[model samples]
Target chain A: MFNAIQHYRLVQRNRNRAGLGSWHFEWIYKFFLHTGTSRRKYLVEVRQYDEHLYTVDFYAKVHNVNRYRLRTHQHAAGKLGATVLAIIARTIQQDPQACFGFIAAAMLTETTDENTRRFQLYTRMLELKINPARYKVEAFAENSTIFVLPHGLVSQPDALQNTITRYDQIFREVF
Target chain B: MTKYSAKSSKKADPRQQAREERKARNRAIAPERIAKVHIMADGRKLLELKPVQIPGYTYAF
Candidate 1:
């Protein structure tokens, strides 16, 4: 049931070195999804925290006739989920030992109930797409922050827990 | 012989209790704060950088 959604082709945009601000991101990628008459543009940002830890953040905007507007839902959620999974897969491929953390942003949601639904949707997507054997998925339900840790660190439970604690602390302090 | 109290007589549904607890926790976190990190076309220039405050997470231009 989960495999039905097909992801769009992701294109990496060249970074402008001069305009690069203080927040140095490892890379950025974008993809276009054509649904019906409107085209949705999704931008993904990857920020490396340490040698093997990175965070992925992405948002989507609908390309209206003249201007771009942020649209969270386009009736193509499954496709978007698949595309995000593809992005995570690509990132892990680049660095096999890389750990990832991301927050399920509740952008433009009408109410708190809708926000919770969005968070649950992201949690379900990760459960379906990520392999438990290869990576450990830990979700902080209160804030919708999720961490995908490498399975290799499972042997040392203290290290794994400490890593998650440290990363969560850093995420809160910075963002 | 005494009658049972209305509050103590009825048992709470565990699932319902759990659901309410989850909702309360979710309510504590504001939606806007959840996605505070905005990524713009210029790559996060919109954010006010306080690299000195956060140790070991400094950004390099």
Candidate 2:
């Protein structure tokens, strides 16, 4: 069932090089989603906050003549969601103890309602794809932020809660 | 019962009512302020970064 969701290949770039200086991301992954007619470019950045905590940020763009522009086309929403899920799965596999926090910001839309819609879309995707046994998912719908913590940490409730609190505070400050 | 009285007796669908309430609740929650960094120079710099080439690589999901 998971493989049924079509996604483009994610290409890793600059493993050792520094990421965006201002953001301090450790790694950047790039992928192009082919929508039958045109291909959209996407960049996924992973920023490590602590030993096992990280945040993922991604955006899509289209090459317009010479420069790239933000792609606002909504037709590829399914593929976009699938690609992000694949990235998260890959990240967790690489580091079993890794906890991820991210925001479903309405980058393309202007209205607050669109932000809510985007948050709902991301929450739904996470619910459908992420396994409940291995990970504990907590979402702040009002803030459009989500944290996925490893279920192994449930044995240490204090540590888990602290991590969530720290990440929430960081998200509020950084984003 | 009279036609007007019978029409007035009809109740709203519980599922539909719940959905409307959910929508209102969602709308009431203010969205977080998202930084417009993508349109800025930092975002473009990411696009400028050169992509590494891999031999015999094929696109897969």
TM-score of predicted model 2? 0.61
TM-score of chain B of 2: 0.35
Residue ranges of candidate 1 with Cα displaced over 4 Å: A1-25, A62-70, A107-115, B1-61
- Model 2 over residues A109-145: C-alpha lDDT tens digits? 4354233666666655565566655665555554566
Model 1: what is its DockQ? 0.03
Q: For residues B1-61, could you state the per-residue lDDT of candidate 1 as single tens digits?
A: 3456765777898999999999778654334333223332323211111112233331111
- The C-alpha TM-scores of every prediction are 0.60, 0.61
Q: For residue A5, what is the lDDT in candidate 1?
A: 37
Clashing pairs in 2: none
DockQ per model, Cα:
0.03, 0.03
Enumerate the chain B TM-scores of all models: 0.34, 0.35
Per-residue lDDT, model 2, residue B39, is 24
In model 2 chain B, which range of ten residues has the least summed lDDT? B42-51
